[model samples]
Structure formats: structure tokens, C-alpha cells
Target: MPKKLKLILINSSILLIGIILIELCFGGWFSSSNQLSNLGIIKDAKFEFDVRNLYATKKQSITYTRDKFGLRGISTYNQPEKIKILTVGGSTTDQRYLDDSQTWQEILEKTYRDNGKEMYISNAGVDGQSTYGHLKSTEIWFPKIEKLQPEIILFYIGINDFYRVNSDAKYDDIQQMESGGFVSQIKDKSVLYNAYRKLKGIQKATKFEVGHRKINFSRTPYTQEEIVNEKLLEIYDKKNLTAFKSRVKKLIVYAKSVNATPIFITQPTLTYRIRNGVVYGTEATKYLEEKYAYNGVGYYKLLSKLNDAITEVAGKKYVINLSNEEDWNIMDFYDYYHNTPIGAKKIGEKIYQNLTELGFVK
Candidate 1:
């Protein structure tokens, strides 16, 4: 063997072995501690997060815990087999402000256990994510959970997708905000790297835990004329509608590919209460007039259009049209759409009822 070539091979082998050792020893500890292991994936995550919005159900600090899979909701590490159903969407689904046990997914799981059915609903929601992010999870997030194939994937969609359609807010996207790419994959697999990153995250994450989350806006009530100023009762961007349909179908196909059923839960909103021209809202919702400028009613109209598209694409058999349900009022919600604990219970119960009616859950 040539001396130079032999030296290169020996050095390469040493480097590889050292890296593997670092991963097994340091990376293993780091990933497990940071809630990024069991999938060979590292997420930019903290052990806990706190949010304090004036609209939060309680004034206390909201603790968003890191479950075993690095996602929100209860840990299924010991009982992954029982996690047959999952609810995915945006903040409404994540409900960072709500207590862990107060989320609808938790409620649903408890309800099932109460009924002698032992199905667990893994909460796979992310804040500020849209249909684009949800579809991305079909490949990135959900599939990574080893030994788990959800039987039913419930989509609490529409509201976040609504933010994307007519607006150009530079918000959350998996590529822009989440981990990916070659370097990212390598880091995700590296225990030492994960330990360094998690330490940095914990430092910054603490900043979010303190203080009151107060939303202060001019208390201006848009008149009925201003609320429904649009001449068109139905209006939506065609391109947005098309893209939304494609994503929903793709998600459905991906769920079926994993031998799981995809059920589209049409999102309910405070807009559902905008029935009268007067539109006298409660104090909690008085902010909506200021929240939606100029075309508030038109915004509701667009959300309906998107929900309709969901039904059209997924078919009526696979949809839970929450817009059609009138039993809930502003009291059920903390803000525009995010549910309170009481609201979460009602929603969980309602979903269970729908699932039973549709025979998705026994």
C-alpha cells in the first residue's frame, strides 16, 4: 500500500469512528434531553414555552411542554400503538396558551378512554402553519414518528390558510423556520451539535416565558356597512383556492398511503357569529372590528370559500363542517377561533360525536 494513500484511509476511519462515538455518547444524551431523538431528528426546540395573551383562559404562565416526540400534547412514547388518531392544524390545534390536558386532542383521548375505546389523539399542530406546512409534515414530521401509523388524521384547517390567501405576511414556513437540508439533517443526527443548539435555544426561549401578552388596539367597531362593505357575498383568490385543493388531496392521499383515513374538519371561527348587520359583539370579540380592517365580512366570506373547497376536494363523506354547527358561541372561544378549556371539551365531544356518526371511531 502506498504510504500517502494508507495514511488518508486511516485518518478517514479515525474521523468516522470519532464522529460515531460523539453521536452515540453525546448526541444520544443531547437528543433525548432536548426531545429530538427516537427519530434521528433534531428540532429547534425548548423544554418549555410560555405565552400570556390577555385572551388566554388564565392569567398564569402557559407551559408548552416538549413531549417525547418533540411535539405538543401528551407523550405516547410508551403507548405509540394507541395513537391511532391525530389532529393537525395551526395555533387552534396547537393551543399553546391552553393547558396540555385542556387541548381538544387530550380531551378526545380521555373521552375515548371513558367510553372504553382506547384511541389516543396525537396533537400534531404547529402555530402559524398553513396547508403548505401541513402538507410538508406528510413528508417531514408525521412520517418520522417510528412504529406509529395513525388510523385517522383529522385536519382542523382553514383559518391559517385564510391568512395566506389574500395576505402577504412573511410568517411561518417549514423551509424558512424549520430544520431541513443536508447540513440540517447532519446536525439533527449529531448529539454534540444538538446539545450546543439546545443550550442556545433554552437561553432565548426563557425570554418568551415572562410578561403579560396584551393585545391593545383602538376599540373601534366597524359599522354593519363597513363590516359587509363588499358587494360580493362570495369572493376568493382563484389561485389560492386551487393550491389549497391540491394540498388537501395530497394530504388525503398521503394518509391513505400510510393506511390512515384523512378527515377534513372545516374550521369554525368567530366570523360564524357575524350574522346580523348590527354585529354587536361581546367585549372579547370587540377587537375583531379593529383586527380585520375594511373587509372584515369579506374575510369571513373567503374562509367559507376555502372550507367549501375542502369539502369539494375531500368530498362530503370525509368532512366535519364546523361552520354548519351553531351550538358554539364566542363564549366557547378565547379569541377569534382559539378554544378555551370549556371550548376544547365541547369541540372534543363534538368531534367524537361526528366520528361515531361517520363510523370512524367505535
Candidate 2:
């Protein structure tokens, strides 16, 4: 091995590695964009949206889009007349902060696609909606989407309804469902196309926006000690339970009307933390106390009660109560009730597995 020859080979290897890294980073592998809320943020005639109000300040290059049917992920222009699954819920299900590639709905969609299965799953999540909103959806929204009925309607309930337990919050307002054209730009296979999108996104984020202000994500982290104070929260009131039960039943009825099976899934809150293999049940931000009479501990407990109501009302066989079954670290959520990408992946995978086990997805 001559000295000059050895040096040339080493330099060539370094160059090759550099090229690959650039391709991966600038390629679709690492490129992403925070889609404008206009693309999927669900602005009903009733929603007086301030973009600042709907998303985290620290926007990333994550793509989020909704079809005319208001379903997240790929547009219905590419879907079958009868979609297989539709997940309904509030912000947790809407997953506004997550890119289309990262939302649990899309994650579920990809899983089926990868397994030689072609199942179309749409996300019908709206921020701040509850069972009440879903009932409204059955009436005003879902009926409008043309030939877009799903076989399984996953009702990811509990979190937003938790507020209505002891307090009076009109947690209902979601856009009417829409169905139409959309192709997923999130995980495009062409690296060149991805690169072009990234450049445009950079421009959009920097100089293109005048109506939106850049707000950073809240960095404050909560601890179980800070949120829980030994006193237990009261079970959700019987009146609320009755109302909640009625709502769930309505959703079920709506599902049956569409020949869809309604499965009530209990969504977990960011109220608790997981540490050292032990799970802490009641824990969330102290700021929650401002909105509700109780702290995070109470919020967690109350939400669980609402969860129990759904299970008890809808029957456990039709519910996947992630609130009681899953354990996620604080990192799973940006706040008390929304998922980060990491959190979304865990959730999406879990739901897919549950559906498979339950024979909802073959």
C-alpha cells in the first residue's frame, strides 16, 4: 500500500459518506414541513381560528393535510368508495402538531400497506371536540361525505370530555367531514421532489407568513409531586355519565347505520409520568388547575372516570381503553393531552395491534 494510494482511498471513503449524509438529510429521509393550518386545520364556519391558537410555536417541517372529506392522510381521490376505518376524537386524534407522516392514523395506514394489505383509514379528529361533537358529526358531518363511509369507526374518546365532568365547558365544535382529492406529500418516495418541497417550506416559514406569529413550544415539565396532593378526585358525576353514555350510544347507533362497528377507545392524558418501571397515575401540569377546580391528579382521575363510563356504557368489548392499559412517558405529549411524534408512533402501533387482535383489521 503506497502512502499516496492509501491517502486517496481514505479521502474517497470520506467523500462518499458525506454525500450519503447530504442525500439522507436533504432527501425525504429527514426533510419535513409543518403544513399550513389552512391545508388541514379544519376551519368550520363557526371556528374563528387564529393559527397561533391551534399549533405549537415551534413549527417544524412536518406535512399535515386533510382531504375534502376532512380526513387526514392521503386524499379520498385515491381511496375506495367505502373506506375501512375512521378514527374520531379531539386534538389527540386530530394530532394537529404531528405531520401526516407521523399521525397515528397515517402510521396505522402505512402498517397495513406494508403488510400487503390495503386498508384506508381516515382521521376525523378535531381539536377540543368530545363525544358531544361526535354526536354532532354523526348528524351534520359524516353524513355529508360522499360514499366515504368506513367499516370501523374508532371513537378515541375521554380526554376532552374529562373537562365536562365537574365543570361546564362547551367542548364541541368540529368541521363537517369532507371527501375528495389528496395525495400524501408527507412521505414522498422521490428525494428530488422532497428537496424542492423543503426549499419552498423554508421560504414559507420564514418570509411567507404574515398572519401567524412563531411561538415556541412550552419547555416546562411537570412532576407527579407537583401535581398530586394525596387527595383523590371525585368520580365523574352521574349526570355527566348519563350524558356521556347517551353520546356514546348515539355514536354507536350512527356507526351501525353506516354498517360500521364503533369502537370506543379511551385516550390517555399527559397527566402522569412513567419512571423506573413504575407508573404514576395522577400527574399533569399545575396550570390545569386554572381551567378546572382540580389539579393534574384530579384531571387524570376524572378523565379515567369518563373513560370508565364509556367502557361501562358501550361495553368493554367495544373499547380499547388506552387510559388504563397503556403507559407513556411525559415525552409522549406536548402538554396534558396531545401526542408528540414519538408518542403518536407508540399509539398508532398499539391501536393497530389491538385492531388486528380484535379482528377489526384482517
Q: Which candidate is the best by TM-score?
A: 1
What candidate 2 gets wrong by more than 4 Å, as runs, is: 1-59, 75-82, 165-235, 274-292
Worst 10 residues of 1 by lDDT: 280-289
Report the Cα lDDT for residue 72, model 1. Answer: 59
- TM-score for candidate 2, residues paired by index: 0.64
Cα lDDT tens digits for candidate 1, 302-321? 66788999989998889987
Name the lDDT of candidate 2: 0.61
Candidate 1 off by > 4 Å: 1-59, 75-79, 166-237, 272-294
Top-scoring candidate (lDDT): 1
How close is every model to the real structure, measured as TM-score?
0.66, 0.64
For candidate 2, lDDT tens digit of each residue in 174-227? 221221113333323335444564464445334312112322234444445434
**Model 1 misses residue 132 by how many Å?**
0.3
The pairs that clash in candidate 1 are 27-191
